[model samples]
Target: MDENCDYIFKGYTPNFTLQEDDIRAIQALYGGKPSKSFSSPLSNSIETYQAVSKQMAPSVKSSNKNSALCLDPQFDAIITIDDDTYIFKGI
Candidate 1:
């Protein structure tokens, strides 16, 4: 992660339970401008973060595609949206 960066960039994708296109459709409905610090979400600038959910062992799969996972959480905050940008104000 960039230590100097105040905001992290990520795509709001499905939890792997739904089709990718469905997630994209939902995102489009909530469209807003990109933050000043980052490019629009539609840009290739969006990122994904992953972590090893299980310990590595002899029988366990160590390959990233098998062990890495990305979890999504719900957050509550005040959001300011304009035609081109959206900012989150959280406590």
Candidate 2:
């Protein structure tokens, strides 16, 4: 896929917790962390970002079956900033 063609979604939801398992799953398919680098606007409150950074573990359980985040087994996925999701064509 063309790098520039990738879509960008926005927002931040502490509840859309992404964990190591998900990262590992992606790594198994595409190798480490894809091609993207972590580059958020640092100008925001450092404390705010640091707080959110700490929330990636202890995944939000799937028990919330009604959770709005749709999971498509066909494509690899990433939790967008909001607890919503982005399904991608994984390699």
Candidate 3:
């Protein structure tokens, strides 16, 4: 039981392990090979963000759209771009 528990914690069932057929069935259903790494979700988020930012760098640098700035009575300032408005409070 202890050995089986250890196997389960390490990410596989000892008695009911996946065969080649089971792996193929999973790939057919999911459309991609399963990842072998056991990385944390936070690391995955950072990796995804870095990849997206690299792809967006060129377009972001070439953008010429200007934002309009104005002071609000309640907030410190307001920045307007297209139909969106962002307010900065306190400072």
Candidate 4:
């Protein structure tokens, strides 16, 4: 078992002994490609975030559009200030 291999998915802990096919299938069902650094905790978080963020972008965009300031819905917009921050106004 790889000492650095640490991942949690769907409420189940990952088995470090997982085969290549298992990893591929998991990636297909979820949304990440296997990486050599998959064994690293930081890499795992980054990959998980990337995968989930892609899945969330559409819905978040739509919600932002519909939830903008009512008086200036056309003018209001969601602004990404940075990776960790955003500016949005709601009615």
Candidate 5:
């Protein structure tokens, strides 16, 4: 475990190290820009930050995927194009 990490995301960590897509995923994950300062010494440049920020836009994911401990709870509504209603139980 990296002690210097502000947020340790182990979800995408390869379990058996045999996932063929691991390399691509690792690249995408680490290549992402860090806006805020991390505990580590890695300097996150503004360009990297912007690129990663673009991929992590709130509009990318639906409201149902919001975690319970969501730091930002303002995303409570989403417009439906087909008028189909779907109830989302609290995650």
Candidate 6:
């Protein structure tokens, strides 16, 4: 057997938004605080944020295919919408 074959492969799908429990589980496994920085440029602009949210809102409400957590830099807030409920947190 090749030495590299000793490593186990794990597959993950991309572009999937993590839920609160998912985030907590990852943190518990990693044993660290989550990063404070936003990963997407969409977080820096309100118009873009609103636009994306508008696009994602229907899909999120209608199905489990897409979910989003967006940051509003101007207000220093993180927003997540699930079905009919919306959650906002300050960073």
lDDT of each residue in 1-91, candidate 6, tens digit only: 7843674333344786878887889988886664685466655586776767676564435333323334232332234556555444333
Error of 4 at 32 (Å): 32
Better by TM-score, candidate 6 or 2: 2
Who wins the TM-score comparison? 4
Candidate 4, 1-91: lDDT as tens digits: 5644663222335564677898888889997955554466677787777677556554433445554343232332344445765444434
lDDT of 2 by residue, 1-91 (tens): 6744676544345677657797788889888753777666764666565566556434676667543333322334455657876665433
Count backbone clashes in candidate 6. 0
The C-alpha stretches of model 2 lying farther than 4 A from their native spots are 1-16, 34-91
Better of 5 and 6 by lDDT: 6
Q: What lDDT, from 0 to 1, does candidate 2 have?
A: 0.56
Off by over 4 Å in 4: 1-39, 59-91
Worst 10 residues of 5 by lDDT: 68-77
**Tens-place lDDT digits, model 5, residues 1-91:** 5554555333334554635586678778787556786665434565566667566655644566544334332343444448886333333
**TM-score of candidate 6 versus the correct structure, residues matched by position:** 0.20
Better of 4 and 5 by TM-score: 4
Per-candidate local distance difference test: 0.44, 0.56, 0.56, 0.54, 0.51, 0.53
**How does model 1 score by TM-score?**
0.17
Record all residue pairs in model 2 with backbone atoms less than 3 Å apart, i.e. clashing. Answer: none
Cα misplacement distance, residue 90 of candidate 5 (Å): 2.7
What is the lDDT for 90 in model 1? 29
C-alpha TM-score for every candidate: 0.17, 0.21, 0.22, 0.23, 0.18, 0.20
List the pairs of residues colliding in candidate 1: 33-84, 33-85
